[model samples]
Target: MIKKVILLGMAVFMTGSIAMAQHGGPRGNKRGMAKDLTPAQLATLQTKKMTLALDLTAEQQSEVLRINTEDIEARQAEHEELKQMRLENDQSTNRAEAQFARQKARLDSKIARQEKLKEVLNAQQYAQWKKMNRHLERNRRQPPQ
Candidate 1:
């Protein structure tokens, strides 16, 4: 009887462990963590991170925060607009055209953001920021172990 109880407990424990592992933590395994966040929240997080990484002054921090907030808002709006376009099922917009537009808009936003950062950050800081972004891109491309 004791051996049976021990075996039963082990099986239960193993099942629970497997269930939790498949559940992907408390949030249900969503891939993009930021997808559900508000633009303001995302912007604030990004600005704070940048401030910490770059040792920004008060003025620079405020400027960077404003830039981040605006960037986030723009991106959110673009995403919503694209979503609306998809929902409308407008055959007028071909897949290639939509993709091209999206790519162009994304690149434009990046260029504008880089230029704004260049204005706010000194040369050394800007170079450091570029390096940081490159490293992050590299890490994002690699498969997780």
Candidate 2:
């Protein structure tokens, strides 16, 4: 009976570990490993995807690449800033104010990006880009099926 119990416990532990390894474990595949990518790599990949989806011309592609690079670099900087802010834990700062500021900044950035895209893309392409953004936002909010 002792031997059987030991074997059963070992089997359960092994199964749990295997499941963890397959499902991204603690470190997580949550970012799809995108957190590991450099800003330039992210920009290039995003621009290429947009080009493919929008059938962008050479000029438009270049413009979009620049926009993507700027956005990626800005986001990286903001991420680092937020990391530092979290580390500081300033008791003087209001958490609600910080949250509101962060959200407002993000919205402002999006609005600026949309304006830039509008200047670069035709009406049809702009519409398509908006549609693509909606789809991406939807997917980001939902867990994998």
Candidate 3:
């Protein structure tokens, strides 16, 4: 009986350690540098870059700033919502509802952004914007050297 009890305790400890290690025991993925910045700061930075890239007029700059602000706010809200969902459902695998909602939100945001950009940009600028966006997306998918 004494030997059996010691073995059971050892097994429990080993399992617990393994579980902790799998779930980012002491050094989980930290927030990236961009996440450390305020949403307003990020919006302003992105808007300025877009303005420079597209040679935006003052009116276009303001419009782009507004769109960037809305985009940043929505992204920040989604981040918080995802974090909350993770915390609440750590071991739950039934994520269909959450996944559906996330997908819908992403599509809705994309459509809204495209419409807003269409209204704000001339045809040539819109074409340039789309090309630049595709290039950025391609680069983003590539792993850093």
Provide the lowest-lDDT 10-residue window in model 1: 24-33
The TM-score of predicted model 3 comes to 0.72
All candidates' TM-scores? 0.80, 0.81, 0.72
The whole-model lDDT of each prediction reads 0.89, 0.92, 0.86
lDDT: the better of candidates 1 and 2: 2
At residue 40, give the lDDT of candidate 2: 83
- List where candidate 1 sits over 4 angstroms from the true fold: 1-10, 25-36, 143-145
Best by TM-score: 2
**Model 2 steric clash pairs:** none
**For candidate 2, lDDT tens digit of each residue in 39-112?**
88998999999999999999999999899999889888999999998898765878899889999999999999
Leading candidate by lDDT: 2
Ranking the candidates on TM-score from highest down gives: 2, 1, 3
Q: Please, what are the lDDT tens digits per residue for candidate 1 over residues 1-145?
A: 9999999999999998888778874566554778978888888889899889998889998899889999999988998988998899878968898899899999999999999999999988899899999998899999754
- Name the candidate, 2 or 3, with the larger lDDT value: 2
